[model samples]
Target: MIVISSGSNHANAQTSMNTWAGATAQRVAYSTSRLQNRPDSAVTRDVRSALWRTPNLDASGIRVRARLGTVTLTGWVPERRQISLAGHAARSVRGVRSVSNQLLSRNSR
Candidate 1:
């Protein structure tokens, strides 16, 4: 009969497990960054459309920046109401966690 002992083989198994864990951590980090950056692209398009149709907003000058799940709306609109409206519209989009209203009045332009 042949028996396997736990010294060398156990060491090798532990090392392999550590290596796999390190690789998994690296992959998770990469995936997280990709997910963070993805919102920037997706929200830009939605912001454009929502701003265009919002009666209170001046869509032409509006810009949106997204990081992680946060959105910031910038540039000028004709009315104060537009600023609130812009933030509301951004918040309504899927994956938006928060919004910063940086919209300025048209007179400020």
Candidate 2:
């Protein structure tokens, strides 16, 4: 029987474990991103519905997009307050992680 060095073996094993851990972390991040993005369309629809349901807010010219639970509102609103209203409505929807309001008041143009 031959005796092997324990220190060398431990170092090599540790290196392998570290590599595996890094790969696993990357995979977990990727999976989480996909899960977050999976409901984007539903988020968009819900935001649009919220805007429509808001009083004095005309959603006809508004467009909504969602990614990773982040909602983006683009387009125009009739009144300046409507911009904030649209943003608030979008934020009120469930699953919305954040809101980017790009809406411009038609009166501002």
Report residue 19 deviation for candidate 2 (angstroms): 36
lDDT of 1 by residue, 27-98 (tens): 999989766544567877776677787775667778888777788888888777777888888888776788
What lDDT score belongs to each candidate, Candidate 1 first?
A: 0.77, 0.88
State the displacement of the C-alpha of residue 82, model 1, in Å, after optimal TM-score superposition.
1.0
| Candidate 2 per-residue C-alpha lDDT over 13-39 given as tens digits, one digit per residue, 9 for 90 to 100 | 777888899999999999898655448
Candidate that would win on lDDT: 2
TM-score of each: 0.58, 0.64
Misplaced by over 4 Å in model 1 are: 1-38
Q: Which stretches of candidate 2 lie over 4 Å from their true place?
A: 1-38
